[model samples]
Target: MKINWKLKLGSRKFWALIAGVATSILAAGGAGDDTTLKVTGIIGAVGSCVVYMLAEAYTDAGNSGGSESKDSAAE
Candidate 1:
């Protein structure tokens, strides 16, 4: 199967997920003792979920070829 690697790399959701993973790793690697790093990691993970949801919503809306009015309303 052909994978759309470009699409994945271009996605904000993908970047968010990467950031989340990086932060989580940092937190686990001795940085977790620091409250700020722990908090940052948690926030990064939550932000990734939010970004993924938003990205999926936009992708679905675009694919459905919905009305511009609906899109404008969302904005």
Candidate 2:
């Protein structure tokens, strides 16, 4: 089955998993709380934008035709 990029990108669970893993890795490397928090926040912020762009591209291709912004009620 094809992954729903939009849903995955917006998923709190997905983001939480990413944060957890990053925190674990940083902690294992003996990073301080401040560094870990800052890195995690930056990752989440940049990741949000990147995932959104990728998902739009993916779902647009999935529709296979016109570039209608169907999900956006205002559009």
Candidate 3:
């Protein structure tokens, strides 16, 4: 199957958003008090869930054979 770079890139953005949110949560937690910890943890959990959901959606959208690129590029 031919790979669709555009769709793959869109999926990458969703993952990137998740990472950015997680990073922000971590930074907030490190500098925060108890309330901050709760908020940040919640944010991180929500962000992680969003990432997982997006990954599922992306996978359901179809593989597009990007898995081959991912495997070969590492070799």
Candidate 4:
């Protein structure tokens, strides 16, 4: 099967699902509230960064004729 990594990585729902699963697993393993919260926060922060970077890259590519963004051009 083919996967769209760029789109998938930029999705909030995808990241939230990951955080939810991680939180559930952590809680099941007896992790403390603070630890779980930290993990969740990190995940959210990283997810936001990923989305921002993808957006910026796509925007730059669109604005610059995909000169430096061959990876995001057409595929």
Question: Which one is best on TM-score?
Answer: 4
Backbone steric clashes in candidate 1, count = 0
Sequence-dependent TM-score of model 3: 0.43
Q: Roughly what TM-score does model 4 have, to 2 decimal places?
A: 0.83
- Candidate whose lDDT is highest: 4
Backbone collisions counted per model:
0, 0, 0, 0
Model 2 agreement with the true structure over 1-75: per-residue lDDT tens digits: 999876787776788788889999999999999999998998788778867887788787878554455646455
| Model 1: pairs clashing at backbone N, Cα or C within 3 Å | none
lDDT of 1 by residue, 1-75 (tens): 898764675566667667667777776675645664666667676666766776787799787776776788899
Models sorted by lDDT, best on top:
4, 2, 1, 3
The runs of at least 3 residues in candidate 1 whose Cα sits more than 4 Å from the true structure, single-residue gaps closed, are 1-33, 66-75
- In model 3, which residue pairs have backbone atoms overlapping below 3 Å? none
Off by over 4 Å in 3: 1-32, 63-75
Q: Kindly indicate the candidate among 2 and 3 with the higher lDDT.
A: 2
Off by over 4 Å in 2: 1-15, 59-64, 67-75
Candidate lDDT scores, in order, read 0.69, 0.81, 0.64, 0.93
lDDT of candidate 4 over 1-75, digit per residue (tens): 999999999999999999999999999999999999999999999999999999999998787885647757746
lDDT tens readout by residue for model 3, 1-75: 999654554464655665567667767667456655576566566656666776677796666568777888999
